[model samples]
Every structure is written in C-alpha cells, then in structure tokens.
Target: MPAASPQPRRPRAGSRRDEAARLAVLHAADDLLVEHGFGALTVEAIARRAGVAKQTIYRWWPSKVEILLDTLIEDSDKRLPVPTERPTAESIRGYLGDFARFLTDDPAGKVLLALIAEAQHDPHTAKSFHTRYLGPRRDQERDMLARAIDAGEVSPRLGLDATIDALVGPIVYCALTGSSIPRDLADTLAEGLLRPRSN
Candidate 1:
C-alpha cells in the first residue's frame, strides 16, 4: 500500500507564515515566563526570542499583557461559542470540556495563570485582562443563558451576570489556585447549573 498523505491543517485567516509568526511570538512569551517569570518577560524580549520585530508583536497586541491573553485566547479558538441550537446541557458540557482540556493540555494556560497573578497588583493589566479576556466570554455565556431563558430552560429571575460568574468561577478558581481544571468539572457545572429549578 502507498504511504498515506498527512491530513492538511485547518485553514486560518492569516497567511501560513503570518500564523507561524504569531504562534512564535506567543510561544516565546510562554518560554520567557517559564525561564524568567512574568516580570522578566517583556515585549522586546518576546520579539527578539521569536525572531520577529517588536513592531510585529505590537501590530497584533497592544502590550505584553494582551500578548499573553492573546496566547490563551488563540489556544482556545478565541473564546467559547454561544449555544444557539445545541441543547443547553450539551452546549455547556461541550464548551467547558474544551475549555478545561485547553487549560490542562496547552502551555497557553500557564501564561494565562501568570497574567492573572500579574493582574492582581497591576491595575492596568487588570483592566486589560477583564476587557480582553473576561468580557467577551462573559458576554457569550450571557447570550447562551438568554437563549436558555427564552427556551424555558433557565429561570428569567436568574441574574445573568452572577449566574454566568457562578458557572465560570470554578474553572477560574482552578486556574488561579495553581491547578489545571479537570474535565469532569465541566460536566458538573453544566448539570448542576442547568438542573431543574436549581437556578
């Protein structure tokens, strides 16, 4: 039998080299964090280590904080999707499963945790963290919950923001507490949060 050809990679928006350069920058951030910690990882260092220009990193991200956020965001397909058609239970389970897996399996998660720790004392990074990383995902989850309300799966009385936080808080807890989220936690969150009359 002839040797089978390797499967082609999925098409991304940027040119192949463009994507490679971005990944190079992100991975360079990861490596710098590991070797020297966040205080030592600077944009210039990342650009030099990645063999890309400092301007190149700036073109895609505004700061080292965003570069780290983008690193995790890119690793997770940017963010979780709002469930429009899938059953609420299945949707939450699927989103959370992929999320936990990404955190557990990818170096991106390390950078994410580092950023979270960095954000604690730096107000500027905290703002970027919420705006770039937390805000969109929260909006997506809110949309999903709104759909669930319309479908009569979740209570109209449920506070959208807090509930969204409740569902997502555990994963964040794991990440901040120096642990990778286990996949089963996703199932638990989905089932518990969506359980009949539990809201």
Candidate 2:
C-alpha cells in the first residue's frame, strides 16, 4: 500500500495567532505602505509579503488600515513612551516634544496623517481609528492632566478635553498643513498649559 499522504498542519487552537506571524503581518503592512502607499495596500498583498494566509490577515485585522494602526501604535509605544518618573510639567513637556518629533520624523507618522485624512471621508475608518487608537491615547493624556490638576501643577479650571486639544492640536495642524514644526512648539504649548498649584 502507498504510504499515507502527508497531512496538512492545522492552525493553532483558539484566536491566538503565533507571535512571529503577528509581527510579520505588522511589518509587512508597514513595508507595503512605504513601497506602495495606502491606496495600493491590500490584505492579499500583506498576506503575500508576510507568508501567511489571507484569511489569517483577515482573522486578525478587518482592514489594511487596522493593520497599519496596530503597527503605528506598536512603534510609538516602543519609541515614544511618555516619561512617568519626572516632574509632571517636565514629563508633559518631554512627551509633547517626543510627539512632535514622532509626527514629523517617523514614517509611521506619515501613515498616521494619511489615516487621519482618510478618516475625514470614511466614517467607519474614523470610528475604528478613534475607538482603537485615538480614544485610548486621549484617555491616557487626560488621566495625566487630571493628576497634574489634583497635584496643583495644571490649572483646575482647564477642562481635560480642552487641555488635550490645546496640547496636541498644533502638532496635528502643522503636520496637516505641511508647515514647519518648530522645535520650540512643544515648549510653548507646555509652558502655556502647565502652571504651579496656588494656595
């Protein structure tokens, strides 16, 4: 009798994909974005580059934008962490400077701006971007500001939402306009927003 044909390997149980596969997908997405721009990126292409099944990509991400968003978040977390050990004002200032530099200097930053532009026209994209990325980041920043307020570092009268807008709005605006992002912009914003607690 002929030997039994080789059996195809089965996928791992449950929803947890292999870590290597996950990183491959994220890196593939970023590579494709750099090579072809967002308009040309697709799950098929990402799967091809990542050497994973297209279904695997779909199983992990609903869209290329989602993959890109995940990649951006991962890169940012590693490269642009907000300092937690310093004085509140110094921390905020350092974070703002880091954020501005990230936006202006990183490849992922260009993709982020593209996503933001796409979000303006695509409500689903907007919702996903906000729910998955922007919303969480905003919450983190807000908590930081709330702590500063409690400690009397930032003014109590400053609304967290407004404070957030004030802090990040300029960087986003300059990025959108293709204007020069002054290095001192972060310092100016931090100085304007952070104040000592008064008795």
Candidate 2 per-residue C-alpha lDDT over 76-106 given as tens digits, one digit per residue, 9 for 90 to 100: 7788765555337778888899889888888
Model 2 scores worst on lDDT over the 10 consecutive residues at 81-90
Clashes of 1: 0
TM-score of each: 0.72, 0.84
Task: State the displacement of the C-alpha of residue 188, model 2, in Å, after optimal TM-score superposition.
Answer: 0.9
Which one is best on TM-score? 2
Q: lDDT for each of the candidates?
A: 0.75, 0.83
How much is 159 displaced in model 1, in angstroms? Answer: 1.7
lDDT of 2 at 130: 96
Model 2 deviation from native, Cα RMSD in Å: 5.2
lDDT of 1: 0.75
Off by over 4 Å in 2: 1-16
